[model samples]
Target: MYLSTRIDKALFPTAALFFVYFLVMVWVNNSYAYFLHEYMGAAQKNVDFEFVSYLAILAAYCSFLCSSKIRTPGDLVVVLLILVLVPHALVLNGANSFAPEASPFSGVPLAVLLGVSLVGLSNKIHFYERDSGEDGRRYIVLLASINIAVLIFIVLKSLGHFSLDFSGQYIRRALARDVFAAGSPSGYIASIGTQAFFPVLFAWGVYKKSSFYFFLGLLNVLVLWGAFGQKYPFFVLVLIYLLMMYFRRHGQIKTAWLLFFAIGFLLLGVVEHEITDYSYINDYFVRRAFVVPSSLLGVADLFASNNVNNGYSDTLIGVLLGSERSDPLSFQMGVSIFNNPDLNANVNFLAISYLQLKYLGVLFEASFVGGVVVLLNYLYACRGSFLAIPVALLFATKILEQSLPTVMLGSGVSFMLLFLVLIAAPPQRRATGSPQQ
Candidate 1:
């Protein structure tokens, strides 16, 4: 049953308070252990400034989310970020492998916070859902044709015989390695299309009780999620599905569903480790998958090293403008390559923010990101824009978790192009001031 009291409204504020409590406790005990402090230097100013900046971004995001009445995908995005970040903050065991005095959070916390909050604002329009009238024999043939075609292509490409490693390890470290070579056109198609709202459309099919669409959608999610070997996005997809189901039906985010999802996630992790080895799980899951805080710290160190490029990296903007294109990881992590080849190359979007503009520039980029989302809400609005939610969610993830500039330059910009595919008129056409159809 839908509760009259919206618990989600409290989520942002509550999370903010949770972090505050942790901070207070850490300070009081004189044992504040966060890897960010370790990497940015053990000095008080490094951690203090970074923590203050983080608090400001959190306040801004919570303010925006709390202002809105209905639940949006931003709610889940914010929570997922906290889940990724806070635990990393709490656990600190060793000295940083990178710089001991690098304060990355001072520049980046806002990037992620506002990046996600913008997704919520960008989807203020209602979902423009329509009834798909009948599932005739022709409909079955149409769905099956594309579904089978895509699935077969994916299966063949993944096989050992094909020898095409689209497995995302290329962006990990050095690019010169033989394993880092590029893949076929179909590989690029699958990678780019995966982050769009393909699964949401399929889920709509499942909601319509089309078994063909359901299985196709399910396999699409599996392959896309497994491509990276990180399960965070996999479960994030599930969370998206749950939110879509709830919002489409106008219901509360159930406690039971969250519990079930958490348990299932834990079970999957355990099962994988049990089948494999702890070394594999720790290296991939703990170290690489949870690389944000440490990677951000390293980027902060890069800033301190005075390795700033004179101009914008010239990659993301070039790609976005149709001039030059490159992979997000390689392009963003170019500076860090010489410092340490094996260093985490997935330095996140903030690295681009820093490389382009350095410290104060991070703020400009964060504001630019947040403002762009708000502008997107304005540009893409419709009377009932169903497609906006999942697409915005994808965009938010790209900005927050991936390289910010490259995404804005590459797949992120391409997502907006969907308007041409999905809309017959300009977004302004269906707006309220315009004549209603």
Candidate 2:
């Protein structure tokens, strides 16, 4: 059947059910995990709630995807409702059912789920084709130049042309070892280049309307993520900004203003550091700064723990990869990475990684591999929005995660962009005549 007929009968029920489930999960979660230990428990319990929400939202969106010629507004409504409720619900509930930490209860998965939802919703927007414009040759050349420079820097480091040291004293010696052991260069300029490249490329993608630029940005971000580890959110912000610019271009200034206000209020604590003890925002920013250095230091300190010829290096990686939740291992890893001869420092990168991956198995490949797949799937599926900012965002996450443990966080910027895209997407069969709006 047609778009109107199909959505009338099939989509609304699914949307209502999805909303009901989300509300219950957010409002009436009577379990201790949802109430008593909300903020105090490890971050994983909060993540578990998000994983459930994604599954539900994903199913709801899939039904929309199946509808024949789904109307643009219908798609917009479904996606917006999910994006608003799921992540914000988690944020509002916080650690103590309604704990008061900055950016509370919610994290990256929520941001990513919402980002993906926005792109999916945007696919239904009718993009009016432009009269054949100049081919995107100049854009491709510029991006290639940028990628080559970064690649060259990576090669030089691998060959030891310069000592790659970005870990300043903010971290302990042992923790530094873990950072070094991961062994990718943390060079000051290189680090910035890796992080900055995605946004630059994303803006190009939008201006040129080039799919090649889009995928290139996506692939580069993933590779950077794999090389870096855990600090992918910075690059995601770049993508979100690109989308914001797009919305503004499409005459969605009012929508953008509302999003800025909401995110500002939601992440106010994080922005201001109001809640220090067990704060998710603090934990994310502080721990990330230390993780790279601590990991490098942990690698070096492996020798201190035991004699040579006994597989010290392998032991360090094993320690890094194994016994994740073991409290003792956590302490030891920290001391090694931070070079805490006095044993006061707490470098538990691997312990955190392991604890999160314990039930999944030692490989912990889901965060690495499956996360990439989820991001790439979103990018390719919405190819129509090749120049779209949210798509660039989808690419950046996968790209950053490739080298870094760029687990999606409820990024302030991404959430803002989701709101913008949801609002910018045109009503059914409608089209803005010019890029100038």
Candidate 3:
């Protein structure tokens, strides 16, 4: 009886979250299928909505089981999976009609289920004892200072002639793209500063109630935005602030609230579009942000199903094996689907995995990603620092769009993990034996 009661307690919040999430998915799926399809030329197939609804429900159930508890990083990943991956999975089912050879049903659902289960199981495994110690604030400051120095150097070298011009954002973005073209070292440094270092500084500021550091971090974000003409830094800043504020008040991050706010924002966009016929919100948020990316998965599946798998040739493993180089799978997919060689249709990790090794690739990628989530959970548990929450959230967003290897190595999430560890490390003893500040 006691065990059953505990199970019920664990499941109650999960059930409520699942209900709201399901409704949101249904609404969004319908919008994608009909409203956006007709209005914005969004991709869709003639697949039956009833069949897609059933698949979504099954995926949602798997998500619910994975999200039975939400106190850990793994649980948070499941929430993201529910929001991003499940929707993509539904789109894939419809896309299968467009690419029957891909047979998305053969592996997508099983991959998601396995991924969620592994993450949940790994989250429950405790690898380290909690250290009841002061946070490594000094180290964070040191890291932030180093990041600032690096940013200054990069700006002086690469962006010396550029000035902030929000009014001409597209022009500025084109210039920024030229400045930070692929394989540029300064580009990588700038990415690390904005995506990893500054966010951590800002989160630390919020955790310590330091308004000066908070503003400092925010100013750096604006500077990076102006310099790079990238909007994601601002988005990351807002997301981190919201997460920090929520965690401060509630003592835990609630997935339901995240979903609720997201749905509410989308609903407001829908209303705005209906009232004013202004399609900015619908175009950017609904179509560009979610629908376009989700639709690309179908395109990727089609390309991968009909062609030879890349066999990991686009990654470092290929370099180690001396495999012949080829255009990245994203660029290849873009060329195949849209006949645009310059276009890159980067999809989520699952689609990327399938492109690399077919169904078996999905299983390996799922397990690997699950392991990464476990490591993040372990780091958060050991540190007990609220700052880690925002960092983890940033990393989670990366998973939604990029493959695990790219997110970790190329996008500086590995550096974020390193920062978490450094911030949790023990401080050195003073030579003078004075009381430590």
Instruction: Please list the residue runs of candidate 1 whose C-alpha ends up more than 4 Å from where it truly belongs after superposition.
Output: 1-17, 20-70, 73-151, 161-187, 202-210, 224-233, 249-293, 314-344, 359-368, 375-381, 408-413, 424-437
| Candidate 2 or 1, higher TM-score | 1
Steric clash pairs (candidate 1): 40-101, 40-102, 41-100, 41-101, 126-384, 126-385, 127-384, 128-384, 128-386, 349-404
Provide the overall lDDT of each model, using Cα atoms, as 2-decimal numbers: 0.44, 0.36, 0.64
Every model's Cα RMSD, please?
Answer: 8.2, 18.7, 5.8
Give all TM-scores, in the order shown. Answer: 0.59, 0.32, 0.84
Residues 287-365, candidate 3, lDDT per residue (tens digit)? Answer: 6556666566667656755788788888877777898867778888878877888677877777677778776787788
Instruction: Please report the candidate that would top TM-score against the real structure.
Output: 3
Rank ordering of all candidates by TM-score, starting from the highest: 3, 1, 2
How many Å off is the CA of 216 in candidate 2? 6.3
TM-score quality measure for candidate 3: 0.84
Better of 1 and 2 by lDDT: 1
The alpha-carbon deviation from the true structure for residue 426 of candidate 3, after best TM-score superposition, in angstroms, is 6.3
* Candidate 2 runs further than 4 Å off: 1-11, 20-85, 88-92, 97-129, 135-137, 155-227, 231-385, 389-437
Worst 10 residues of 1 by lDDT: 86-95
Clash statistics: count for each candidate: 10, 57, 0
Candidate 3 displacement at residue 148 in angstroms: 1.0
Alpha-carbon shift of residue 101 in model 3 (angstroms): 9.4
Model 2 per-residue lDDT tens digits across residues 266-354: 34424444454344533443223222222222232332233222111222344565633322333443454444554432222221232
